[model samples]
Target: MRLKLLAAIGLAATLYSCDDTTTGIGDFVADTDEITASAQTFEATTKTLKYTDLNPNGVFSRTSNAYLGKFTDPDFGTYTTDFITQINCTEDFEFPETMQDIVSTTLELSYSSFFGDSLAPMRVRVDMLNREIDDDGEDLGLYYTSYNPEDFYNKNEEALAEQDYAVRDNSWTKEEIDSIKKANGYYPPLVIDLDKARKAKGEETFSAFLKRKYNEDKKNFKDSYSFIHNVLPGFYVHNTSGEGSILYIGAIWLRMKVSYLIESSSGKVDSLVYTSIPFAATNEVYMSTRLSNSGDNLEKLAAETHNTYLKTPAGLCTEVKLPLKEMYEALGNDTLNSVSMAFTKYKNISENSANNPYKMGTPKNLLLIRKSEVNDFFEQKQNYDSKTSFLGTYSSTTNSYSFSQVNRLISQIFSDMRTKEEPAEGWDEYNTLVLIPVKTETDSQGNTIGLSHDLEVNSAKLVGGEDGEKIKMEVIYTKPKFNK
Candidate 1:
């Protein structure tokens, strides 16, 4: 009996590629059998829900890239981003004993790309942080998208440095940029000079202050902890003036130039050596971004009953409600072979617009997970398990994000129903799922190894809502037919 059952299941598994219809076991088997196979399609209702309350706990987990500047979208409204980061200091770092004078101190913001008008002028301000990011050697727990920088530093105080610049360097020609890139492999960073004693009303320069602190206390330079807490806390980087562009800053570092005497063997000064010492915002320390969204566009879109929307960087997400109990009742005791669903995206017409030229693009990746586990999934830093959670990539050809096989998710839902005291009748919290925009980390072979919340400016309009076209879920299963 066990051999016959195994043979029947093995044959039924091959019918996964068959059309949506019922098939008898005797068709594959030479002899008549008591089992049958079938495939069915069902419409699963999905609705768009607001996903504005995102708390990443720490920004590092979500994205390594930091953002700065402000941009206003016609569809999504205005978004402004600024960041606060702790600079990492080398352990037991010390200045040269023959140091003569501080030449200059500058903050370099290095970026790979930017969104919006590259020629748009913007002023970035760097302020010295007086408060520690961590709460007395513990996690701050206030690292949300809506974090307030005023709580950490006084805005009324004089800023350490500020620079008015554009994202693209217009001074360098295209040929010059190409030649420089070919030779150096990268472009120069936007340097903001911190030693502004001549410009500001202060008596001492910031560089001299740093040198004085280092000389006064050597123990504070022991590690990043002591350095951030005692010596130099951190910096609050914000946009003080201008708009229209947001830079995708990959790394930020503070460089201090010092002129020191290089002595010869005869005890004579040979040359005045000038070099820079850098303190960077590495992964060893904490960094967070404060994101703010203005205007009533999001609220207006969320209330729409037709097409649903998906936005990123503390924006909206779509909610889907699947009829699991209905599927169970329709296909009772069937071995679910494969389950597939697709969310078609509406073609964006605003991309070709002349006025709003720099609109946000659609998110490339989407995460479909149970609504109840959304918080735990991000907080615990869990990957897609394909049971209660799944990852879907957007297809430009089909204009959809399709989950090819979700049989395990269907099986898990059925397993949960079996454990209940009574059969679940209607749609509940367990049947609902959320669609989130995510950033995926893949290996060299293009296999996704890690997942995080995408902190980019993106939006997608999916064709499924209360009054919209219902999403179709295809299910292929095999069930037994008892002999009469």
Candidate 2:
């Protein structure tokens, strides 16, 4: 009797919210006329995504760049990454250079954070690309994840520069860094010698190139693209040894400090001053990931309990199908208050050790996207809206990914049913939503501006099993209003 009364009151609320004229309860109306909300649990399917399908281009921003490291996990297989970036000279200088004038040269890489063993030693070899390629290339910068380094430049023949980077630095969060009293507590800059680079590639050395650009009739080394064409393509940084950790390389650049003799207008000569030319933001950069082995098994993880999962870097995702059509028919003339879901997270007790991969645990949040919009969402870089797009953050203490936007979504669907007849449009068409592991990008103020995926190279497990309290969706709905 109470259930019927609640349903009746809910129906009245829905009609009133919808501005309907005939949804009020009558004097003779019994408690049976009440409308009620229901909770439904469904099974989600897990699947693996191919490296080519991840759409890695432009997934990362300037602040949080790609990760560099190699990790061999017992269950997740071996994962390695190669970072390729193009740096262009800013504020061109016209000058002649002698090898003697070349002072200290370094390649600087700034990082925000890291994952894996901090004390573990890792070697990164930097190679120059001889071939002309851009992110748009068919098999170049933005090429497949299976891209081979040898295809662009043979490291054995062209070892330009290298560095042994420490992933685990005294890295702090953005807020902590902002609160620091010191002016220089930020991520320590990685500086490596690029001085040999000029001498290694013969006359193509950056010193000579700069001299030519600064002096004679320079036809080739005029602009950034021209410079890439005349001398070198770009640089590729990859792991040589150490599966200890993966460093989150934020922004990278090659700085060449050349000591040059600048003559004064007077007869007297001025002391030599160092001129630094950096290949920075002017050019394009791309990073690739190699899964190395067959550890990617999101579907298999679900088998132990019938739940779904959302991993990363071409790993896995969960597909959720909601029975909206059936629910729509049952609601009749009623409107919905809201709907929401809570997917439980699985705790990996075995990974609790102070481990490398465990150090950088999986996503703290996940995005629930429509099946049709999945492609555009990832490739185009879309954000969440309470209506069609929704993302929920996971609280380890809570052990569940709870989404509160479900009610609003259901209400919109109920409104759609009132406006149209058969097979509605937009979100209504997508009965299945994919729970994709993602890293959200936010401003310094902590307001999220965009969404990114597969760049972090992490994995996570979730509960989607049947015959238990797995993925729970609750719908608060009311009956339709009949005309007076």
Candidate 3:
């Protein structure tokens, strides 16, 4: 037997010399030797499932931008988004004592981009909150996308302001828009005047009310907490009328234009200085968005078996049922070398269509994680460990998101199976994984530093499902020649 083993080693070395493709010690050995190497591909079952994370705690702690307006997709139905936010007031905030009067009070919704028809007419309404957002307690504030704004304000009462506008400024000529873009690199915000108070008749204007509050007590402007609780609660902003458009609002600003008298050294009024004080919605204060979806079209799409869909901001996610037990049974005591899986996106056919020209693009980043660990993983803001959790970037050239190697994931799953006294029978449910759309925050060096649920508008159709073509997962492994 010893002589035969030595002969096998010598033969394996000769094989390695002849084949430059030999990768490992097992690869050099023949099937008759002590160790053998081989590769095989398995099909993984996948299907789309409706996703919602409206837990009492929160779905996300914070978001980079707020979504507003309503958009109806040809296949996916109608999506409406609204937000309630507390504007931050600087600590010890105060207006100059020489301030003459309020010129204008405007709520500016600043956005870098929007989805859907630019010319679609939309109406937005803003109302002052009667109660403060509950954020101060043992538990952190709830920041999910399904919050109710009616809890903070009275919908029956008149709103502070409402405006009819479009995603693109129809009032500005092409030349004027180009000039503004040349100077600012972007267009101006959708400004809504809030000077008039519509809540009550014979009452002070919204700007006058702010001035009066500051005059009454300066302590009310001591900090954001005090300001939101005492002086001004916040604002509940929603679309009263709109369709076929959704704006990705980056920031919300409440600007108060003031005309102050500039005095000379002798205390004589010389000139007037017009300026604006801005109170903005920031991370320090609480902000929540409410997302609503309607229509049977979305239901029909989610039930599609030929292809799986991925939609963002409280939409569907593809669930993959990994056959770990089957893999273990096939390769009893083998060592998993590598496992590669890729999800190819279906090209958008509506891109070239004249009727439905505006189509949402696929999510730039995706996360593959175990279904059981998803909530904890996101709640803890954990990054992909490349083991149980992995990240895939979309490749425009190939139109696919591929995970080149997941051998660690396979090894981990197998290790878990070994610890059980008996063969794990009902663990298939826990062995499942989910694919989620994510927005990744990168550093200056282009390294990903943070990950969160993508709140922007995005849709993707992947080629995989139970009744459709199953996703192919290439697995490479080595085992004892006798076992094989």
Strongest candidate by lDDT: 3
Candidate 3 segments whose C-alpha is farther than 4 A from its true place: 1-36, 53-61, 136-141, 179-185, 197-202, 269-271, 349-355, 422-425, 480-484
Candidate 1 lDDT over 104-171, as tens digits, reads 88888887667899889999898888887763424434555667789889999878888898888877
- TM-score of decoy 1: 0.87
TM-score of each: 0.87, 0.74, 0.86
Model 1 stretches with alpha carbons more than 4 Å out: 1-35, 53-61, 135-140, 179-187, 197-199, 265-270, 349-355, 421-426, 481-484
What is the C-alpha local distance difference test score of each model? 0.75, 0.57, 0.76
Q: What tens-digit string does per-residue lDDT give for candidate 2 at 1-484? A: 0123246455556434532222221222324344343333332333334333334332222223656787666555566766666666433434354433445556687666666676688887777777855555344334334556677777677566665666543455656545541455436665666656656556365445545444544544555666666655777777787776766666677666767566677855565667776666343544444334344443345444454555555556666667666666655445455455777766651353234445446677788777667766655557887667788988778887778666455555556566666765644474666777777778999988888665565655566534333454555444433333
- Positional deviation of 93 in candidate 1, in angstroms? 1.5
Give per-residue CA lDDT, model 3, range 117-206, as digits (tens): 889999999999999875653333456665667778999998889889998897888798778767865566899988655434666788
- Lowest lDDT sum, 10 consecutive residues, model 2, at 19-28
- Candidate 3 has an lDDT of 0.76
